[model samples]
Target chain A: MALAKVYVNYKQSILNPEAEAVHKALKRLGYGDIEDVKLGKYFELTIADGKSKAEMDKEINQVCDKLLANYNMENYHYELVETEAAQ
Target chain B: MALAKVYVNYKQSILNPEAEAVHKALKRLGYGDIEDVKLGKYFELTIADGKSKAEMDKEINQVCDKLLANYNMENYHYELVETEAAQ
Candidate 1:
């Protein structure tokens, strides 16, 4: 099994000027569908076999804490998506 | 063919406080792997068939300009990695 990660955020966080510029351009493009446009990160990782879901989950948790997450300006939530084989 | 995106960041741009904290922790971890670690974003997308590379590149540029990239404090660089099948 493999693990993937996705992060969602507003491109401009009152922190990133680049995000703000994109936000302005998006507004001009008439994508008025959204009130605020946020940007996020996504990751897809392949895992080694022979480990249970629980073990994988533990490792993933550690990775998120140790490497994947910032836990300050960016807010993150995670989910597990099954590939066709698993289904 | 499909489109994939990867965004690299320093984690802490002297802008994101959370990324800064994580950077500090990493330094203390004793891995001593490097002087600094930056965080990045990665995306993998499945594209509809029948599009040429140039066509896809155009669309990707639009997406990055209109959405994915902030164009301000955060700088972004992109590359496309072919999948195993293509190789």
Candidate 2:
């Protein structure tokens, strides 16, 4: 099996309220050294076997676009890692 | 600057409604081959310089405990990568 670990975050041009709130809180809590904090969603997907890397990538992108991320507000990127099923 | 990519996910023993909902939706969308889907929060933190890795790790853990993750219901882990300040 293959696993795709996806990270989705708001576009840099967009204002992320959640991140801003957290950043302010961090500063208030005396974490003044933290330059920035960007918050996002992380997803772990277990992909079935027998697909080429290219095919899997395509499927992953389709999933991200169709179900996972809101493209107007967020951008997503993923890293694929192979996994072995228990014998 | 140093970057810490934190991933916070609910413990396996706990029931995650968000993941369950997404899993069901994926199946409805014809992604039956996806064995499972786990959702979590990803945080990108920009840490200031002049701190050793050990010091940063300790501070990261403190921040995670106090502000980021709910230790009672969720578990958090992170990978630290050194980043050069933009010239």
Candidate 3:
């Protein structure tokens, strides 16, 4: 099987309210040394066997573009790892 | 400076409705080969200098326990990478 570990985050130019809230809370909680915090999404996708590496890569990109990420506000990057499937 | 790249995910035994919804959507969208999907949170923490690695590690754990994750439903893991701060 192939596993796609995806990380999706907002564009740096975009304002992220969630991250701001967390940063404020962290400072209030005495973690002032936390210079900055950016929050994002992580996805683990397990792909079925039988596909070649190139095919899986293309599919993963498609999935990220179509569902896993909002291209206008967010950007996504993924690491594709091959793993053995249990019989 | 140090960057903490944190990944938080639900325990395997727990059910994730969001992931399930995405899986269903993917299948409907003709990505039937997607065997499974797990959703999680990603956090990028930029830490200020002046702290030792051990101190930073402890602080990060505390932060995770108190803010970044819910032990009841999720778990977190992180990679600490050293980086040069912009002067």
The CA lDDT of each predicted structure is 0.50, 0.91, 0.93
Chain A TM-score, each candidate:
0.69, 0.93, 0.95
What TM-score does model 1 achieve against the real structure? 0.45
Model 1 chain A: worst 10 consecutive residues (lDDT sum): A30-39
Q: What value does the lDDT take at residue B77 in candidate 2?
A: 98
Ranking by DockQ: 3, 2, 1
Worst 10 residues of 3 chain B by lDDT: B78-87
Instruction: List TM-scores for all candidates, in order.
Output: 0.45, 0.95, 0.96
Across A40-71, the per-residue lDDT of candidate 2 in tens digits comes to 99999998998899998988999999999999
Write candidate 3's Cα lDDT for B2-87 as tens digits.
99999999998999999999999999999999989999999999999999999999999999999999999999999999998721
C-alpha lDDT of residue A36 in model 2: 89
i-RMS for every candidate (Å) is 7.9, 0.6, 0.5
- Determine the backbone clash count of candidate 1: 9
TM-score of 2: 0.95
**Chain B TM for prediction 1:** 0.69
Sort the candidates on TM-score, descending order.
3, 2, 1
On DockQ, the candidate that comes out on top is 3
Which one wins by DockQ: 1 or 3? 3
Instruction: Considering only chain B, report the TM-score of model 3.
Output: 0.95
Please write out the lDDT profile of model 3 over residues A1-87, one tens digit for every residue: 888899999998999999999999999999998999999999999999999999999999998999999999999999998888721
Candidate 1 local lDDT, B36-84, one digit each (tens): 3334454333344466777667655666665665656555556654444
